[model samples]
Target: MVGKCPSCGEWNTYVEEIVRKEPSNRRAMGGLETPKAKPLSLSEIEPGEEERIDMHDEELNRVLGGGLVPGSLVLIGGEPGIGKSTLVLQTVLRMPERKILYISGEESARQLKLRADRLGQISNDCLIVCETSLEQIYVHIKNTNPDLVIIDSIQTISTESLESSPGSVAQVRECSAAILRFAKETHTPVLLIGHINKEGSIAGPKVLEHIVDTVLQFEGDQHYMYRILRSIKNRFGSTAELGIYEMRQDGLRQVSNPSELLLNQDHEGMSGVAIASAIEGVRPFLIETQALVSSAVYGNPQRSATGFDIRRMNMLLAVLEKRVGFKLAQKDVFLNIAGG
Candidate 1:
């Protein structure tokens, strides 16, 4: 009996559509390709550094492994109200020498202007446009000839070729492919802002991540003042690099010394506090670790750790009991890593 799809195992969830192959009237974004491919020897290939544009934000530059690479498609994803737009806008505004095109599908020109005004940095080279149509965006890009292009969000963009709504898997994939092609052909860097799913992944098909050259993830708690920019993937640089910023009223302020900012000076003489040195990439920094030892209030002692590996902590507890001759089996122990 035809009941549910055996593959998906859902009842009445399947729909069929007739897809027609129609000849395109639209001209190719890249003129008809007539060039043949050829193999080059290792000696024939030029050995030089890839050209990059300085983002002017040291933290951002550090995470990017230097700066924005030419003709690169970079995708930045974060949760709502996570300052992804602010970080991008501020970076573009700081680059006064380069012409930047900021296209927003989610916000109006007035709203962006208000944000820019609050940011307190103005550049005559920056142009702002509110549009969602992918074709129209390309037309604007052709006329503007911007050094850099920033789309506020990719999910809000749609192409006329697709009958599906924007943010659908089909629409997201096609629009991203179009943008990627344009960036490569014109040698213009494109920055796309994206939303995160409830599962904390970039909200689109997995192919969206594969299409871009670099993927940056903005992560932090909204209640906290600090945010972390981590490179999830980078084609031209190391992915181990990360950047830190402090969310302020003006804009995102780069945290040059995260160790100093994350450490609490008031806890200097505290018994439970200790400092540990760790290295991320080639950069070395100090992190605070706290441990609390107390008598068990309940019949069973409770062991809790935040930001510290629970398994490792248990191993340490076993060491304390076995090697150190401590009668801590019946006691409660809690460990936490500060500012993690």
Candidate 2:
């Protein structure tokens, strides 16, 4: 006689199972929860001054919407070989008054000290630890009670409850969640260094970005000395703000006047060069626009542009021909935004 399984509703899916009871020993992976508070009306809530910690870097401070807010979780992501670690370390070294905990899951204390020495600034209050276990990290946090905490790279840290390996989706999600909970409970600001995937997005689930208070992206070509720190998401500030830096041997230097440095001072009388005024996050600056017009040597004219949108260039060229009455439609035109 055939018997159907009630759950699966299939005759062949039925099977005998053995159940065994095991003692549960897994401890909760979050900070101690406080007693729930009653909801307050909007009018009953009083706004207090937000204490911000200065990073001592003007560019960084501007990108962070004036300064770093306490109890905020900020994530900085970038491509490999970018100056993400250097930027964070330099900022931390400048803050001598604040007690900082530099947690490194990828590097050792000796290596960090060596880098700090090369940077030529050392803070006595700064502490370094080479650990990867999330639980143990929390223990150290409780013991040290630092004013600011920085995680070198979140992808390298993991928890014991997760069966997946480090850098996995499950591990990254759980570790970030734990950190967020701890930050909120302790009212301590946490800075997280994150890895970017091939597509340039943060290497984790989308929910990870949602949990953070601010998200900053460090972007630049390794071949170039210029780097841009941009805010992708900011709960307390504007997302349109950006910071510029020049990578040097000692450390990353803030570019106070990016417009002056970006413009070519000697190219005033040069042909095919134009200067245009632009605004980036309330700052007005001048930009150099260059155009190159040449005869088409091949049968098909090649059009190229850099640092500016290609379609916009095409539309401008069409306008020049139609409105300005610039003949020579067969000529090749190339445009570029200098020092982009």
Best by lDDT: 1
Residue 75, candidate 1: C-alpha displacement in angstroms: 0.6
Off-target runs (Cα >4 Å) in candidate 2 are: 1-38
Assess candidate 2 and give its TM-score to the true structure: 0.88
lDDT of 2: 0.87
lDDT of 1 by residue, 240-264 (tens): 8879999999999888888976578
Weakest 10 consecutive residues of candidate 1 by summed lDDT: 28-37
Candidate 2 lDDT by residue in tens digits, 128-168: 99999998887788788899999989999999988899999
Predicted structure with the largest TM-score when compared to the true one: 2
Task: In angstroms, give how far residue 188 of model 2 lies from its true place.
Answer: 0.2
Cα-based lDDT at residue 11, candidate 1 = 97
Report the poorest 10 consecutive residues by lDDT, candidate 2.
23-32
RMSD per prediction, one decimal? 9.4, 5.9
Clashing pairs in 2: none
